[model samples]
Target: MARPSMDTDTRPTRLYSALRNIKWEYLVAGISGGVVSTLVLHPLDLVKIRFQVNEGYGVTNRPKYNGIVHALRSIARSDGFVGLYQGVTPNIWGAGMSWGLYFFFYNSIKTKLNEGDSKRNLGPGYHIMAATGAGFTTLVLTNPIWVTKTRLCLQYDKPAVSTSSVHYKGMLDALFKIYKFEGIRGLYKGFVPGVFGISHGALQFMAYEEMKTLYNTYRNQPIDTRLGSAEYVVFAALSKMFAATTTYPYQVLRSRIQDQHRDYGNIRDIVRQIFKYEGIRGLYKGLGIYLWHVTPNICIVFLLYEYITNWKSNRPDNHS
Candidate 1:
């Protein structure tokens, strides 16, 4: 018996066509997966900061947690589980917006950028451009949530944690409280560093896209069949490490700006104060923590994203 010929029209020609056909199931799956993973992993983020900022206080010590499990246990012992989830609500909002927008718009933008050029996939510039757009958009949209989260997370160390000091109980509370207290300017305390941290997104997406493309090229060679789960994990770790290292100082500044007290007039004055007190290093107070936090976070994020994308692509109805 002769084999049947495949129909050329069955294959998608335009990238937008493929993106347009993506089911809501995949979008939901991606967003939910990101949320769960972020919430679960946030405690390590807390511990990483503790270690990072300790150096500033003259506590030159190594992190107690060698891995996530140890980090959780240490944090629970020291500050309780509530401590582990100090800023969870805002974390949820920030992660939801950041990841949701990044994935959704990245696909849409890449599709549009590469329109009529199917053979040539999106390059590093496309990844940078897509991430830049997503970064600025998410920064503005989620800045209030992030400010609230920072206040909540850093509030624990204060002698008295008053509602006046903390200000916001939840997302909506934070938004309304800021507006009532400081007007429109309250929501944008760290606009400069917030925008600077957009470079983190640009670097992250650029590195991830470039690395995945390299992996695809390597896998196609006769010497290698495909990347295994372990290979994927390694690539994710390396990509995150590079991105985090390159853009970590901006993150530290963003946290400081967002977590400032009412005394600080604005971002410019705050930057000046940090420079006056701590010098250039003051602006980068929690850089070590950021680096540690981002490596595992990005690893999980990309790993989950790839798995979700692959699962969606393999489903029956995903076909054109």
Candidate 2:
């Protein structure tokens, strides 16, 4: 009974094999994390938009509440908790798909890029490659979800009488209804800005990767071992902030394109409208609120993800 050969060229290392096997776990974790985070943070997201869009609404400015709590209070007082979670269905759908795609492609791309590279010398280029791959993948996979989420979130307190068609009730309802009303085109109202929004995703991954690399470099240690909990939070927050700042105007346009009620002749017309009506300032309408909303959320997400990944990787059974 000869023991299995450890030096066989045909067989991959245990760690390499294990890493390849966790694709489903990555998807599940991404989707579940996204859903839970969106639900918890949605109320704030609502307020953030209100503050961004409406000038006279006069929402509270307390740092603690940000926009969501104020919106929740206003809605609850005016409407109910129902208002707090106005487009919950779309949010969940968007989050689940967006995050699932992000993590799946991010891991896949990073793994492929790392295949021949020595683990001792992974560089900034690897991070950029991974981030770019994740960003592009997320853009295509979740654009429709974003379009739906924008519409649902932007439903006003006052309904207007218009000639345009109205479709969707919540998330799934909206999805099916949109398809029925306008076919495939209805669900992709903001395709142009949506594609542009890829910049945000790319920047996010780039920032995260760069920050991780920088930390590892400065400390002269392996990132997997040297990155502390606080470091993860800091890196995540900084990355999100940088990404948000660099591409915020596109984000505003993307939201507006999705949520608005207008018959633009084409993407050019929509862009013209955005610039004409909102001006330079209008293009950046929700920049502040976005940073407020996205930064902390990303920080928490990375923190949680790193902790979980590290814990699982370090488990006795998972060790190389």
Candidate 3:
């Protein structure tokens, strides 16, 4: 039996051959990983966003959440277990689509850059460049979903009264309201910070790729050989932690900018206010929870993505 020839830029792609061969596995794996991870860590994500936006204006306002424990308890007592999973609909949509697009672009770009070298790791530089491309592309396309998700998660038992028409009933309603009232600009509020935050993925993918390469080299294994699930978890956790910490402040700013309950003037104004009112500690409001939430979530996603992609790749004549 003959092996399938690798697709290269030089070769003319015959119809959906490239699509059938290389793309579907990534799409399935990425979307599946993203949805599963979001469901598991959504409560913690809600808590993190709440804490991020809880700091207020006047001295009298104080902060709504003192810490993670207070925030979690407050949410559970007030909104019940269901409240913790608020915005999950859009959250799932955003996460799944973002990751799906991310992996597609990541693998696509990486393949293009690799030319025909199907046998070597692309190293850190190529990995960074490819990841940056994927991050920027995925984030821009999915920002609207994220905006809607943020608004939903920020909701409390008492609905926020926006001069803008109606309150959000669900994902579709939120998107419609945001469009009707805030316009396209409203849906892209956090775009600048989000663009800046793209480095998180770039840095993360670079680190993850490098770590995996090192791990493989250390084990004297080939690049195509699958690592144990535990190894995947460790590499993913480390990469996610690095990305989250480095880009965390942007997460706070993004939440506030998207919060229907609060209004922050501008990035500088928001930065100044948080620094003045809540101090340095305020900038890192829910980082502990974020790290806790993201580490295992990424671990799950990475493990599943790698395994699924590998399984499909190794299967005979398994085109999409």
Q: Candidate 3 overall Cα lDDT vs. reference?
A: 0.84
Candidate 1 lDDT trough over 10 residues, lowest sum? 53-62
Query: Relative to the true structure, how large is the alpha-carbon lDDT of every model?
Result: 0.66, 0.67, 0.84
Best model number under lDDT: 3
lDDT of 3 by residue, 1-320 (tens): 96666765436666566656576778888999999999998988888887777776542332388777887788788778887798999999999999889998999899888885656789899999999999999988999999999988866645463343357989999999899998999999898889888889999999998998888888898875677889888989998998889888888888888887666787888889888888988888778888988988998889879988889655878754
Q: Return whichever of 2 and 3 wins on TM-score.
A: 3
C-alpha RMSD for every candidate: 8.8, 6.6, 5.9
The regions of model 3 sitting more than 4 angstroms off are 1-13, 58-63, 159-166, 313-320
Candidates, ranked, TM-score: 3, 2, 1
**Cα lDDT of model 1 by residue, 45-75, tens digit:** 6655443333242222333455456767876
Better of 2 and 3 by lDDT: 3
Model 2 Cα shift for residue 104 (angstroms): 1.5
Q: Give me the runs in candidate 1 sitting further than 4 Å from their true place.
A: 1-26, 47-79, 116-119, 157-167, 221-227, 260-262, 313-320
Q: List the residue pairs that clash in candidate 3.
A: none
Error of 1 at 118 (Å): 6.1
TM-score of each: 0.76, 0.80, 0.88
Task: Show the lowest summed lDDT stretch of 10 residues, model 3.
Answer: 157-166
